[model samples]
Target: MERLINLNSKKSLTNEQRQAIYQRLLQESSNGKLRKGSISDIANSYAVCTKTISRIWGRGKLHVNEESMVDVSLKKSKSVGRKKKQINLGEVKGLPFHRRSNICSIANSIGVSKSTLHRRVQEGALRTHTNAVKPDLTEANKMARLEFCFSKINRSLSNNDSTFDDMFNVVHIDEKWFYLTKSSRRYYLVPGEDEPLRTCKSKKFITKFMFLAAVARPRFDASGNEIFSGKIGIFPFTTLEPAKRSSKNRVAGTLETKPILSVTKEVTRTWLIEKVLPAIRAKWPQGHTGPIFIQQDNAKPHININDSRFLEEASRDGFDIRLCFQPPNSPDLNVLDLGFFRAIQSLQEQESLGTIDELISAVQVSFERMGSRELNNVFLTLQMCMKEILKVRGGNNYQTPHIGKGKLERQGNLPLQIDIDENLINEVGSYLGL
Candidate 1:
């Protein structure tokens, strides 16, 4: 006989803890029974009472005659924990969209804690959805989108497999604004470290510069060596001007970067003639001297590129670079909008840039830092989206498909293009009255 387990000290032992205690009891035992005070010794080691240890030992002994392995599964009733709060989904869904916009609001409406509602969401009992406003498409827009998808399908291919054109000659161009800093940023800081403070003149007035990015599909040689990186150029809309007045940061007469407030047709045309076309000429592969098509959205600046000014300049340098517009409101058709711009923007945001020049440099660096494989994947994703659009009869209301591009690439089996069903193409054409 030894000291008794303190009744005041008690805990609900887990199945693992009970099994551990039973093993300890057997170790302290001789032939068949636990030694004197072994129950108290094991219970005190596990921070449980003597009765809890005894119950575990009893369970282990009951299985001794029948089986060597003891089942230490918990015997507590299912009703031991707190009951799930009753949720009337009808009452919850009846709330206005704005009223139940967040977990807290929905929880209050259903008379539960925020954690309970969040738990329900995690357990799939409740779901969170996000809806974004889509561009209003008319009959013409849908037909145009359908026709565009039909055009991408390689009609020249001999097989019945509905594969998209390799699009090696097509370059995607899009305009996006690069801000100096994000409004809110998350940072991981060590405990007792002071939180960072970042301020600007105003968020609306934060230094931002627009860029026109152009990328073509990356090409690989027989050995998979990268031939052309497909990065044409990321041109910043800024003009260099000498500083009129001296500032604490810079001396007077220093050429300061002045961002172009508005990029009109003239500005876009100038970039094409001066910046974009030249970069394309220099970077385009010499062996494959084909007519490169510049695919762009139907923005006002991009419209009317058939004019002599654009055609005259584009036809220069022994390269025939033609301008073509994707269907209106069909961003999925363009590789840039499908995901590339966001990818480079995310990369650009990682840097701490201050001046307009620095921001421009960061954007260009990010554009270059992107591997050719990612750009190629975006093109494949563009084809996948076109396939999805055809499935929905040219509507943009389709989830983007995910084929494990990285996994496939790791296995050295990434396709240059995605193939679709031949029937989908015919059905889309019939739906569009083509």
Candidate 2:
């Protein structure tokens, strides 16, 4: 029937003329093909019946060749709907709470419109605060630190009557501890991994650590800095894995196991006496005249200043080993504690070592790979910290010179042992802005 209609409709027209008429009709209806434009308008313009145009261009049904029917839904939408124009605003400057002004100021400063700024504020966009200026370390503090280090260095040389130029004769001593696991409360397991799998329990795994280490200052390179320095003395600690027991849970067929681990002060004392002292003696054979210092914490084991065996060992060697006790509980004052831990944590995160041997190897490699320069940087940072401390509390004899608690006690509640005079407190308070 369509073929008969087409033939009758083209009876007065040549094939080329008929094709041209059909193409002209298609061109007029092409725009309406994708949008809300009227098919009636297309039919009137192309001299075709509305019914014919509707039949050919029904929804998604077209008489046109497949190649010519490109999707123009987007173009149609843009042509019919209204659009917004963008404007340029200048740079914004002030904070919200401080300025307490309308969004227009921010919009002008930020090169955006007030509407945009208000919309962001409504959406909880926060303004950044400008930080106040900070004061540098005072000159008095700097000079005091310079004098402290130089005085110690000089006193060391004078006591021995050695040439002030011989830096090797001065042995700097420090001790550090390393923890096996990170000291954080949180632990995560991968999805689908079974919990409480067959693994060594940290407590029952005989987590006895390798010995504490003591190193002497290394000979300086031509650059006047310490090189691959110091002898390491490991005083292995004696810790024991206690028994493990499983407990029945109230829930049917459920059980939990807890392992017991234990350590003793005797173990520590013996390690220091039998291992550490002997190691120091072997390292510095020269009597007190020899360059040796057992610089360490005032810990009962290391300092053991009154221990007959430890003192005898030092005195016999003619090495006037000094037990320089830092203010108690001030781990921040000891760079090795913080810096070494940071390095250890960084190295451990990249690799997981399962066995004790592997972990030990990892630790040793981490320590060895950390260049002397890095160690010196740690020390330099420590030096700066020490200077800062002295600048704040130089030459003052507080009844309690050491601060064991994490925070300082209030002036009124502070014990007389603190020995903080009213004048000094006022001065220091002003220095710290109370």
Q: Report how far residue 13 has shifted in candidate 2, in Å.
A: 57
412, model 1: CA deviation in Å? 3.2
The number of clashing residue pairs in each candidate reads: 0, 17
Model 1, position 49, has a per-residue lDDT of 73
Local accuracy of candidate 2 as per-residue lDDT tens digits, 1-434? 54344434632323444344445545655444533456555544555455554544442244334545522221233355544433332223344444435566656555676676665555656444445333243556444433443333222223333111222333333344344544343447899977643344564433324435554433444545554444444333433343354345234333322211232345544555566556666665333354344444445545444656555655654445444444444444444563654674467445555544455556666655565545444454444444344445543211212342223222323221112233433444465454
- Local distance difference test values of all predictions, in order: 0.85, 0.44
RMSD of each: 3.8, 19.1
- Tens digit of per-residue lDDT, candidate 1, span 1-434: 22344566556777777777778888988888788988877767776678877887788888997777788668878697677776777888799999877998888887888897788789888788887767888888987887888888885366486588899999899999999998899999999999989999888788899999999999998788999998898899999999999999889999988999888998989988889999999999887767889988989877475868889988886789898888999778888878999999999999998788889999999999999989999999998888887787778888889999999988989988888787777777677677
Q: Cα RMSD for candidate 2?
A: 19.1
For each candidate, what TM-score against the reference?
Answer: 0.86, 0.41
Which pairs of residues have clashing backbones in candidate 1?
none
